[model samples]
Target: MNRQVERIFSQIDYLSSAPQADRYGLTKLKALRSEMERHRHEKYGLSEVISWAFRIKHALASQDHSDDWREGISWIGDPDASSVDRTLSYEYMRSDQKLVAGSIWNNYYPWIRRNGWSTIGSVHNSGMGAIATWILAVREVTKDSSQIVLLTTRLYFETRQLLQRLLFGTNVQVIECESDCEFLERIKEPTNSKVVAYLDSAEQSDSLSLFQRISSAPLPKPVVLVGWDNTLIPYWKNPVDSHTKLSAPLFLMRSLHKLDQLGLEVASAGLLTAASPAQLTPERARYLELLLSEVKNSMKVIGSTASPTTIRRLEAFRLPNADLAQDSNQAATAASDRFHDSISGVLPKYMEAVSYPHKVFVTIPLPGTNQESISKVMDQIVKQCTLSGLPVMRSPSVGYEFTSISSFLSESDTGDATRFLRVSPGGHDTDMIDEISQCFLSTVSNL
Candidate 1:
């Protein structure tokens, strides 16, 4: 069997074996399995759909844990109260409302037009979907089978894989750059083929600067910039615990407007909804409209001064760590100090930690410690927290596997890692922090 096909089947088997499979609806599972078998021979479309199905299943199964953990930390878990009914709420909304791809674009059109993009020609299922569509669109426009794609540093492993897979069987050249200087220098070279520059939050400012330079350059070939802003949403505030969000619509609007301003075409994607374009019905459109309205209202309540011209600045208001009336710099310093002190109270002696803007990453280094050992330690920590009714998440170390875009962009690498735990202080109080600290300490001491 093809390796990818085998992997897909393995994922289906894994989902089938999940203890909570029935909770996700056996009929849905059966239908997905049937579809998987029917499309086993398909190399492109089915492969992507199956891959996405694995993610959707995992997200659905993990909701209980995620909700409990988020609630313990005083963070918003399920904004829509989807978990109350034991149904995949997002999926239910998509299906029952008949939300499809076209409706998604239609609903987002107002936001897009307000942002200055007159029209978006196509829509895709996810951010990766948009990217794939964009790649093909570029190919069609340039009338060239070969092209060059420039990628910024710190791209996720899965994203890299998707790009490679999508670009396979073509002479497309992908170049990875570690710094702005390198990216700028490379694009300085002239060519008559399509050139796509992909940027993520890892280096947003730098990427934007490079993009501006590219837009202004007197090059012969068409230049387009694709931006991934999936992490821009306020997850800690309205954590509906759903995998999808308004990210696709937001990304589509932002990218299209920005690209149009530069006299270029753009393609973008986001993890906004699991439903495809074909699913958009009238009911689905209404549900999407309501969801987007709630999001905007929530932002307003949080004092987000975002407008169509400055939507990128939309973010949740973070409570100050310290009660100080000093200047901005002094207040910021005091807040950092207070946060570090709070984290120190919870971290185990076996672990050494560092704090970033939004979260803290703690590393536990034991003699001969490897990834497996670290994972065991993480499991123990999680178990203890669960027993004690605390909510915390196991996250990858900074500069390693899956750091947040802000952390990845702002922080420097201290060293490589076996495992690390990330703790966010958002929506958490001092007592809650101490309780979490005790949980970690207790687990480490017992070990």
Candidate 2:
């Protein structure tokens, strides 16, 4: 009778006792999650889907009734439309389309604002394009041909490297510091060039102090703070003490692919400027204006314009965005809590001490003196997870070497031969989480 199992049953029993409407909503949520999971693995990414949506939107708006246009395109139009204006619509749909996508924004900006993040800009792009747009905008506004970019997010070594090469070599130089201490030190470097720093997650215990330091520190150049998934769930705000207002321009990048549980996967990405629902300082206000123009312009330059279809769908969706993030957070909390509870006193047996670092995931560092042993344990965990039918993954945060989540520790300290695994139960059912918790607990206990 594990407490985790009892908790799962309680949740189920409560659901059974709840009003019919709540149950229906929960059912719809699960269906949406299932659909999202299915489509994410599709060959056609949201970007390409956006292209098709644009082409369709263009065709419907065009006055061209010529034979070439008619012969080239094969799409059925709305029956009531006149000959001159075609109303071609996407054929792919779920019977529950409106019920699912019609309300994704039910939570909307309020959820973000409630969580101490403000909406930065009025425009957006899709997927990773949102982040790229933010970076490009920062580079453009700074007007520094050779500028410094500080990355403090806990991402894979490969992901960090990709950022460095995103632009021309001389345009933007990315500095991947081993710790926030280095970031804090480097931010003070003498440079008139506009500096853009990326910070992520509450995983780092020092995030609040870092923010306070950034606020008081006299930065050489105007600095802008940016992050992805920060649109709703952020590594930007310190979980312990969320300070809504800041001295700098804050741009939260969003990709709803994973954020919005409603499966819109709108391939929609947005460059949010302010940590919204709050008043902006005169300085942050000016920087916000600078970025709006640059981010929108960069999207145009890269042919990464925001998808009109996705926008309409997101706006029209019935569910709240706040609900999506909240539910996802709840799931992560339950999973993480269960993991820690299961392994409570026995963690030291097989691994270094671990703790819940993020709302969406937890890191468990495998104890090892070399790469081979760390990798072997990782493989064992994966095998165990697979055999148990748990959807555990090798996350970017769990680097075998030279990688860390939120740089919680120095590279020299944990980067050599240690490897950690990131596990979370976001978007999972409560009962399934119970099973996952038990399975992983067993796997670790035996180790």
Best candidate, lDDT: 2
C-alpha RMSD for every candidate:
18.9, 13.2
Candidates' C-alpha lDDT? 0.36, 0.45
- Judged by whole-model lDDT over C-alpha atoms, candidate 2 comes out at 0.45
Instruction: Provide the TM-score for each candidate, comma-separated.
Output: 0.42, 0.54
TM-score of 1: 0.42
Candidate 2: deviation at residue 141, Å?
Answer: 2.9
Local lDDT at 283 for model 1: 37
For candidate 1, write residues 163-250 as lDDT tens digits: 5775676656677565667766665567754455555433213433443454343332333333433232222222122222222112
Compute the lDDT for candidate 1: 0.36
lDDT of 2 by residue, 208-260 (tens): 45555665544444465444335335432343235434446555555554434
RMSD of 2: 13.2
Candidate 2 ranges with C-alpha deviation above 4 Å = 1-108, 111-127, 143-159, 171-173, 185-193, 201-209, 212-245, 262-271, 274-287, 303-319, 344-353, 365-420, 426-434, 441-447
